[model samples]
Target chain A: MAKRDTPMLDELLKGPYPSFVKELYKVQERKPMVQDLLGQLEDSYEERIGHWKHGGIVGVMGYGGGVIGRYSDLQEKYPAVAHFHTMRINQPAAWFYTSDALRTLADIWEKHGSGLTNMHGSTGDIVLLGCKTDDLEPCFADLTAAGFDLGGSGSCMRTPSCCLGKARCEWACYDTMKLCYEFTQEFQDELHRPAFPYKFKFKFSGCPNDCVASIARADMSLIGTWKDEIQVDQAAVADYAKGGMDIVSDVVMNCPSKCIKYNGNGIEIDDHECVHCMHCINAMPKALAPGKERGATILLGSKAPIMEGALLSSVLVPFIDLNDEDEIEDLKELIGNIWDFWDEHGRNRERVGELIQRVGMATFLDGIGLDPEPEMVSAPRDNPYIFFQDEEEEEDDE
Target chain B: MGTPSIPEIAEEMFQMVSESMGKKNLKAGDLTKAIRQKYPEVDRKTCKLALRELMDNGRCVYAYFGGSYIQLPHKEGAAND
Candidate 1:
């Protein structure tokens, strides 16, 4: 009696694309290794046994913090069809994996673990899930041997993730990748040790567009910004208008600050009033451009799924000059100071965002020696839809 | 789409809702506001239904023993014991 396998298959076939079960089918036949594993997995399912289990303290020798593997004590009763967990490979200052790397990763997963992967886990590691506990040791050996390692988890500072800022995006105001890499290296000890009150995540984006959703995700968020001018191409704006673009209604009239104006001639921007919200730049991609004097604005206190819902990581440092190495060191020191404070006072599973919220943002600023500014609040709600005092003046006459 | 089995948190939550004497019992709207703050991921209506379950389970006592504005009763002798 070929045990009950089709029910599980049927259940898997019922919903959604990018299904791991469907992906498993791609290698089910061609790969002898996978076929063998699937056969064993089917047996466990027939007995209604669990395929995944847990294990003990395992890391590479000499490296206090390499791969951490887990195994199930009940492997005899519940045979695992696959290994599950994550790996934290060292990312380049701005990781740009070659096609070969992608292929190698896929091949390795097909051989030793589940073929499924999250492009990059929230922890900033190339997360490979579903590897067995026993396979963890060998997998770690192979990975580290091939030059990879585990990311921080369990009270340690997790891997710092960042956007490919200036490397690819024109909106990049600063070198985000460098800061992310430098922070990871600088805080390696903190990354490996689980001594803090809760987890901390740092994410950097090249621009305010926040490709990484850092504002809503990371404990510390770095977004690129400028205190300089907005470069407007008059020729481009004129061309857009010529191309049947309504500059008045679309660009000038819709300017959040009424910062841009068109009077039958060309366009003008009142630079002081521009909030650098990226709306105009996004609206007229060709006409407007970001300024050259690039710097990063640092924010803290963003987390999801706990306490007061999703809080937008608010800006702390409006601008930090990223032009020099010394500046980077200064930023690292500041980060270190914050971690030390949080580690000492944070409760278990409490993220830095939660701690900051509890301790009050004012205390956090005092600890870091940062002065509070009005911009520390959410960027001024710029939508002109609401009738303000000035608008009421106009309404009175009407 | 399949109708989700109302979350257990729904009934589990009414135990926490404080009922003022003169106020209307927990309406779907008020329950939604309270539970949404703590457990925003779950459906508000489901949470209300969970409150209903708690009422059925005898774990929670409601206003007038029937209306909304429910409260989880202290376990017998457990508080002092």
Candidate 2:
């Protein structure tokens, strides 16, 4: 086939500002619609203003989720991609894609919408960039046939996601992939419907290193950790020391808690003071390893902040065994309780963090039937200062 | 008119955004600032609601450049019929 002539983008080839556009075509597979899409990019430019405007409600049937509605400025000028509906396809755990699956997705997208994709969007879904209202059904059907379903797009739960835990990492304290898949499967209703005040996102990280940055991204975040002492290889430590390793400077001194010490030949770590950070293990892989007592810490209220400022998720449930059976059941129960409380009380567009700020932490804990823990509060109230505030005034605010 | 209704206030804000952001796309802050300056009586929440309304109707799109900029819907289509 001759090089797909991207007439729409031809002009950008020579212009001073065309370097980015020219660079896109550098890839061999960057042809056809990707080329065409990029070509039409300048059509939306300030100079080449599109004329169409958004007006009516456009969506697919039966499903109240997945589709994000938007439109073109001038339908006649860019008729090929005038109507651009973004679809969020629920991704596999860690976005694992078989060659066949990717081929299937690309085939479906090519037939129904622009083959352009956002790869994996920040929400951890395979974001199909552009679609028409007419093709949504066919596209959706084909994707579902390929064993792919649409992810949460409306005010319900966003797709549950996790880092590549046991699938490809040694520091994983639990099967993050399995848990993410389970959460996606189990919480279909939350993922498909706009039940809560706003969207909820669940993300998991294998360890406190937080490869996926779950602490800053997810509303409900889980980071794997251990509660016991880090297993030590005394012989390995001695070898490293013997090999002229700076055990005192690197391992002992760098221990955040000052719990590690070198006694000339080997290293010793105070188990009680260990915060379960993977720092020591990372520094000396052969000499140290994660402890045996593995579990996960659940954090809450992380978001980028539209209503309130950006907030990192705070530890809610400090340690929960992430093993199978009892762990899943307990997790489900806790999740349910949390959702129920939020559904009943959360205001429109009020994220969990904002809700907690609006209603006191005491109320949230009481509503969820959870006892107050030291990790629950955003900041410590250790000032030993007490102020009497009338309950009546506070009630009016919530 | 004695204080415009929410929808009316929203429409006014949208018009201002369209006028202010002629060819150049705009951040919510810039548009919000322009709207507030023009319609000082209109509150922030009302302004946001209007922008959201435009977004839902497909009239507005977020150009993901520097933080999210709301531009007149240029690409992407949906059935908001």
**A283-374 per-residue lDDT for model 2 (tens digits):** 88898888889989898888996767997876778789989679779888988888767856776567887787788767887788777665
Error of 2 at A205 (Å): 1.5
Task: Indicate the DockQ of the complex predicted as candidate 2.
Answer: 0.05
TM-scores of all predicted structures = 0.69, 0.72
Residues B1-81 of candidate 1: C-alpha lDDT, one tens digit per residue: 233355546543544454432354433334545666566676633654565565456554432111112344442221111
iRMSD of prediction 2:
10.9
DockQ of all predictions against the true structure, Cα-based:
0.01, 0.05
DockQ of 1: 0.01
lDDT of 1 by residue, A1-398 (tens): 11224456546657865555565666555544344445555655777785443322333332223343433333443344333344555555556888887777677766667665667665567777566545666776666666556676544566788888878888998888877877877776556533345567888888888888888888888888888788888888888888998888877777777888897667888889987778888888898888878888888888888635777676677688886788777887787678656745565466777777788777776676666665675433423221234456689989
lDDT of predicted model 2 = 0.72
Model 2 segments more than 4 A misplaced: A1-40, A43-57, A242-245, A377-398, B1-81
Worst 10 residues of 1 chain B by lDDT: B62-71
